[model samples]
Target: MKNKLLKITTNLWFDTQAEEAARFYTSIFENSKIGRTTYYGKAGREIHGMSEETVMTIEFELEGQTFVALNGGPHFKFTEAISFIIHCESQEDVDYYWEKLSQGGDEKAQACGWLKDQFGVSWQIIPENITDMINDTDPDRSARVMTALYQMKKIDINTLKLAYNE
Candidate 1:
């Protein structure tokens, strides 16, 4: 049977590191893999400025989500406006992702569980039960959780729990 196309797939634009980024992402996530890769040809040399046979696009998957990394040149860059969130069940899980994703990243951009990775991609490392805490019927408890959340960078689950209970 043929594979069905995903209704929605994320496409990342890179100056020239599509393949590299794909490799890095796949390596970090389990059940991830690098898929097909297409190279540039002389057909669009004038517009793209990339040489023939250079990597044009790379297809990759992270935890089953499909993404395409395009070497579309320096016309664009990643920004904090778009970020992938990783929900963790424990502090250990949060810590692991925070450490790995934040390596060689912008330290100054770290705030409220959001971080920009080395590839300039923003990511949110948060607790799995964050929604429940924030959706509590008691506004005071939810407000407390938000207050505690704002003061964190990597997101301490224990602290959030404490705030919610108080």
Candidate 2:
């Protein structure tokens, strides 16, 4: 074995719906595509104790991130601890993603301008200036922004700024 790795990969465990999930996700993102779906043949069945031609794994890419969706049976579930945050420069971007990702999942407001989509995925729909405002030297302004963020499900950058001025 060589002490070298080409790319970082994330393995997602699905409950016999890896192929379906992969297609759904690829449709949502622009630069997304389903790479390949390998099936387990009879030989694989003997080794893994499963039926032949079943979906063993699926590879897909979303926003340049390569992910492998494994139909490894439902042993685990997704949690908010690990989430993909999409930074938005405008309200349109926020609306586009929020509407799509929130489908068929629960929605929850998170502190400091974040939202959890239907699939238990946490997304921080943040504005470009949010980073600067949060890092500002004024503690009062920062506190105001934090307070404003807590009052809403979807982040409104303009509202947060107004709170900071107050």
Q: Lowest lDDT 10-mer window, candidate 1?
A: 1-10
- In terms of TM-score, the best-performing candidate is 1
Candidate 2 structure quality by residue, lDDT tens digits, 2-108? 98768899888776788887887788889899998888777756556656788989999999999998877666877777777777788778777767776776644
User: Candidate 1's residue-wise lDDT over 1-166, tens digit each?
Assistant: 4797647889999999899899989888888999999999989788889999999999999988999999998889899999999988899999989998999999999998999999899999988999999999999999999999989888999999999988
Off by over 4 Å in 2: 1-6, 43-50, 108-118
In model 2, the worst 10-residue window by lDDT is: 107-116
> Can you give the lDDT of residue 14 in candidate 1?
92
